[model samples]
Target: MEGKNIIYLNDIDGKTRAFTIKVKVVRLWKRSNPKKAGETWAIDMVLMDEKGTKMQATVWSNDFKKHEKILQQNECYTVFKPRFDKNNQKFKHFDTKYVLTFNLETTIRKCNNFIGPTHGFEFSTFKSIKNGGVSSEFRTDFIGYVEEWFAREDTTTRYGKQSYKMDLILRDLEGIALKLTLWEEYCDQMQEYISKNKEEEHIVLIVQFGSVHDYKGTINVANAYYITKLFINERNEEIVNFKRSYIGKASVTTSTHRSIGQSGVTSNEDEFLHNTTFSTIRQIREIAQVMHVIVVGTVMAVDKDSEWYYLGCESCNCKASPSLQFPEDDNGSDDVDPKEVLVCTNKKCKRDVVPAVHMYKVSIQVEDCTGIVNLTLFDRDTVKLWGLSAKQLVDKYLQVSDDEKTIPAEFNAFINKKYAFKIHVKKYNVDNKVDGFSINKLVDDPAIIAKLEKKFDVVPFEEFDSMILPTTVSSSQSDAGVKDSKSYAVDDSTPLPKNYESRKSPCDLKRTLEDSNDLDNSYSVSSTKSRKIETKEDIKAQMKDKLLIPKLEK
Candidate 1:
């Protein structure tokens, strides 16, 4: 821990176009409910570095598995041989930074500010503060308006202190909502109180300078500091360029306000539930932003500690009884028995979720063009979407399906459920709403499978066998080509009448094979001399007497 160098999350960010530095150790998280990402599973520090720089770090897979050591946050390490991510396509970001590897020689040094900088921004006008939160610091003062405020009593560990950081969702007259992150220190030492506040409220501020991090082309604020002394500027202060903002759910008003318009149609609620696309802007009324997100993948992993909170429906909640379960007192017994429960991670959906113990889960490392992220999936939600119970999958894959076995064994017997998420990839923090992704089946879709069956007439072997028999005779096929040999022609005296005409030429008379009763061969001869049946050679020879043509004699 002695010789380690100091660095920031931004010091070796993934925004570099040519080259970037790498940290020996870094922080990473996996989404807890991958189906809906509100929380994430915090994996202890594994060997990592600023990746957008080097070219040789591609073989980090083995190192990743081998360096699963218990490391602390805010620690620095010495990494070796990180590969330059030349294939910027490898991940979503167009960067020169690379991924690092941790070998046996890696050493970690604990440092302060594990959560990174305690940043602040100062602006001359609200417009100067366009779309607040962590972003590429503006070169000059920008201003906006305090459109809404979402505050709660939250315990965050920053600067070694557990305090509240105010989160403000502000919008300029342009009507775009900005996700604002506040510093915890201000909670203890602020001149104006934001509390006792309400929505549609207005606030003003002035801030100092900050950095403009491209963040892999997604410009955002980082390494930004606030001015200790500032004032509220209410007057029109040179409208700083419209907040460099992107639309997200922050502007999408809650479905709670949706009422049945006079048109006899449910407004936003229907759209939120049935429709797949929608938009929201605080004050801006025109632009109709469209977001299409759909994803289908298996629930590959789960980490319990990463979950935020669990709530069940009072009516449909599968829990034996709906009640809170706090820590046990002396006897290790909670006030209520949480025997079973359904907790939907997507609070807006409010559908009861499956109990953690009863759910199936899986893990997958998802990397888009934007960045790499670890994801977690819930068992029941995956099951509901994919239609594969854990037991069924385990039984097919592992040959263990009976419920009589241990619960874990039974759960493993079935195919885990799958889910899909609609995501808009960007360089910075991700905005995960319930509708961010789509849910779909992990196996072949039922509709397509059914259509194939109809087109190809595919019937199960069992049903086909029942409808047909192997030995049954078919009259149309069995009697084919069996000619009768007892025809009247076989009796030479039976067919010639008194007035039978003479044959036209020797060629007309039968000669070669024995023609007696050729019925079995499918050839029958009726003996009443009719036509001058002759080959073309014979006909030409008789052309001098052509008056008797083959059909004329008949």
Candidate 2:
């Protein structure tokens, strides 16, 4: 092989020929086989050449000691007398067509004259990953700043082994966010770094050989064992330039900055609606590039044609469909029994079906006096508005007979009722039309509800008690002071109508009581109407006088 020319990965064939190549070991791992009890372990590696081509190589247990110590990661080496074989696509993670297997005749030596980069990576944008069609055959690279992260947790794997997982929210300069999941050793390393750098507000992360996973309608980036490499706040040229492009600049600030509750935003609607402008459905469409707007409309229709919830894989939360069932075997024999399973369509997770979770994705048409528009409510906001979790809604809807083919009565209560919705809008097309709208917050404040009732001629359930009290009083007993009394008395103490049970769910009742308690505890000797208009200073003073506020002891 002295005079043989070096070949790239694309030129590899099964023909026996003498060849010499220089490459670096980018990744290394071990696989075990139960059949060979005495010698079960085999070393596997991913190698990359100067031309940025990669290939998979394996060293069986018989030849492990011969080359295990000689091969070092990120170091160039020259190898000869290697044999090539057809790659098993199911087990291959590299982009090469063939894989290398080491035999007793193979020779490995350190390279002294070669000058090239240790590793080469092809970076992908968040846009492409989010648009779907990311092949699982090969891995990709990603770089972004860590916006937020969750605490490390221990989870039980399908094999009954305990594994640790950490989830990180990453955002790029284009204002796109993606979830990155690290497992086992990677999770430990990240958690260690986070503990050490507790004072740092932002951290830049670089992920190599990370795979894309689709969960429901969202895209996530995950790490593969042994093949994935992570660099956190490293001082490399590429990292330094990426940091400079975003740090200490207004444009970068806007792109990287996010609100405290941006992920879920489950706080009271009053906080979000404080400074927002209220608009009708028609006016909402006329505005351009408005981030948040409030709208009051009657739910004209609930979309029953579309599914209220979807089955998602428990591990990755990707949408899954029922697997095909075969009643008989291929030979037309009835020995095989038919069974149902949920199959994940996402190529990244093609395992045997597992237990699935319910995810909400509901669309409803809302109409105001001016115009009508269709709005969508995702998981969090849907739970808030419907007063039920996705799982609860699925259970309730499935209880009905299949032939009826209608939504639950709880959903029908939403129709012809008024609500103050806080929506986030995105404009699309040349005409600047509002193409995307999602319910961000659900308002139930009496002040806001009263204002909407007066302006839009719509009444909420909470205000119905006040609106009908005056009409129910007898004219003979009416007095000047009767209008000032906030209490209503009935001759009999019978229970309310049964229709009220269908009008509100258990969660709605709990929320109403919580709101009432919040108002009572925050005010002193002030009526509901008076407390609504009180300024921040007045409320603070009232709280200080009536309640003992705790102070931080620093």
Highest lDDT against the true fold, candidate: 2
* Model 1 Cα lDDT, one tens digit per residue, 1-554: 22233343234445532222334332332224446567433232323334322122222334444444534322433332222333343222213343343354443333221222211222433333343343342233334444443454467563676766554444555554544444544433221444321111124333323233443444333122222222232111221112112112223222232221222334433333344332111001111243332222223222222321123322222222243334332223346343333344444543332222223443332221111123334343344333444434554644554432223323333333322232332211122111111121122243322222222111221122222223233554333211211110011123333322443321123432321211121122111211112222322233223232122232
The candidate maximizing TM-score is: 2
Local accuracy by lDDT, each model: 0.30, 0.60
TM-score of each: 0.20, 0.45
Point out where model 1 deviates above 4 Å.
1-26, 31-61, 64-66, 78-84, 87-95, 103-146, 149-169, 172-554
Superposed model 2: Cα runs more than 4 Å off: 1-4, 33-40, 158-160, 248-554
Task: Report how far off residue 54 is in candidate 2 (Å).
Answer: 1.0
1-554 in candidate 2: lDDT tens per residue? 43156666667777757676677777777776757765548788888877878888888888977988887666566777688888775756766668997778887776543444545767788888888766656788888878788877889977998888989888877778989999998998887777654433346788988888776767888898877888776534344345544453324222123333323322334343456777765455446664677877667665666666677764445687897555442223566666676777778974445446676666677655433556666654454344455666666666775633356667777766666777876534113432436776554455555565444322333333323321333334333222222122211233444454454321132234323331222211111111012222332343345433343355
Against the true structure, candidate 2 reaches a TM-score of 0.45
